[model samples]
Target: MPLINSDTNNVNNRGAFILFEGCDKAGKSTQAKKLFEYLKNNGHSVELWKFPDRKTTIGQIINEYLANDKDLDDKAIHLLFSVNRWECRKDMKNLLLSGTTLIVDRYAYSGVSYSVAKGLDLDWCCSSDRGLLSPDIIFFMDLTAEAAEKRGGFGEERYEKKSLQEKRIVESSLKLIENCNQLPLKEDLWKTT
Candidate 1:
């Protein structure tokens, strides 16, 4: 028998990992879905995943807390959301290896941003997403809180309150991109004053 080449055996023609990031009501989801459909129609096998999937077991806990006013501690809910993504990580890798393009609505960045925005440890947030496949292209849909709130029902979720979101969006944008780049200097990803 011929010697097996480990590189060839492991190498797969994965398409790409595309990610969209933004604050709440920034139209990131709408744009992500549109991009996914467009890619699908172009004969590309594609998959869509949203962070805190909120359907898985861990996500269910997060969903209950966010939606039902359940008494889960802040850190607990934050970690549950992080675990939710970790649980699906295998499938995420498998799909990418199977030549399917992944159009993720939100990914580790949002997890870090939103979690750290709540005064949790930024380093902890960054560490939670360690080892996740880096995105081929990351698109950040920029929007202002004033404009976003005008879209209606912005205060529906636990983190969607106007004051908190505005503060987090501003604070987290710079920190999030800094973490994304792992750079010493913080860069603002979203264009807001």
Candidate 2:
């Protein structure tokens, strides 16, 4: 027989999914870490996740593919990135169910924004990430491409080229601003504070 007690069996409040989105050099990593530590110190169970989670096997392949300019079809690489997210979906779900807050440095929105920013259809880009866990809050960190480039040493990665990154930044901003404005809340797409 099973223990039968409504008081004991009641579900506790689950964790929140907070996502941070931004162009390169938006200082998302630094702020995310700070927020995670603050939450943990306050006694909340928390998990910090960075997308393109480059430590996993799939991520390793993606990293190599991006680093060396290894040629792959646009759709192929896009799908691979999406699959990477799928691979982690179960874990994210369990973490939320277990009442542990998950802080993501980047989530599906990055995939859509960057890919579509390359000229893929915005609808298509968004479609790829549909049905994944929707975040309770998405923090978009905004910065101008010029400011990001001025930070220097911009060629550390494949996507670091100033010109291309600028295009990405512009397209991503338009997509986010448009989408967010239509939401009922209608707050600024990035940097609430």
Candidate 3:
């Protein structure tokens, strides 16, 4: 993978904010953790962060919603997802300013894309996440819906199913890449042994 450094005005120059985004079972968490471990092992400061943290109040609601245990309005859930990230904004900025790289499993892109797939207004979804920290480099794991379905945990969560909806989510994710630096990862490169 190509590692792209960030250009920032922070006193310490700040650390790179790297993000991994893709459909369910696309190995975002796995690759993010691996990158975090690699950076740490090399004596660099690094952190691995995931969305819907499931530990905070907002995240708990998100967790329940994802599990299909609780029903939520589309706008409500979308805002909650954005709020979940906002809750971490301070700490994220602090870590980066302190020169610690962050390997994130997901971010605003997922929130906007998934919600938009459900027929929400794209502008509205994007508005909720304004002023969030943007990633210095985003790695889009380009996995087809068919390929993702064959992986484990394909149908356990609300968004894991392979369908036309998921295809749209994947397509929507591409929209976020246009103005940002991208490092595309082919499926073969991410396959587990």
Which scores greater on lDDT, model 1 or model 3? Answer: 3
Candidate 1: pairs in clash: none
Task: Give the range where candidate 1 is weakest over 10 consecutive residues by summed lDDT.
Answer: 183-192
lDDT for model 2 comes to 0.73
* Top-scoring candidate (TM-score): 3
Superposed model 3: Cα runs more than 4 Å off: 1-13, 179-193
lDDT string for model 2 (65-145, tens) is 878657677777777788888789889877776678999997777777677767777766666666577676788887777
On the 0 to 100 scale, the lDDT of residue 67 in model 3 is 93
Lowest summed lDDT window (length 10), candidate 3: 183-192
Ranked candidates, highest TM-score first: 3, 1, 2
lDDT ranking, best first: 3, 2, 1
Can you write out model 1's per-residue Cα lDDT over 64-161, one digit (the tens) per residue?
78776687776777677778877987787677666788999877777777777788887766666666666767888778878888887787888777
Candidate 1 error regions (>4 Å): 1-12, 183-193
lDDT of model 2, residue 60 = 81
The local distance difference test score of each candidate is: 0.73, 0.73, 0.77
TM-score of each prediction: 0.84, 0.82, 0.85
Considering lDDT, which of the candidate structures 2 and 3 is the better prediction for this target? 3
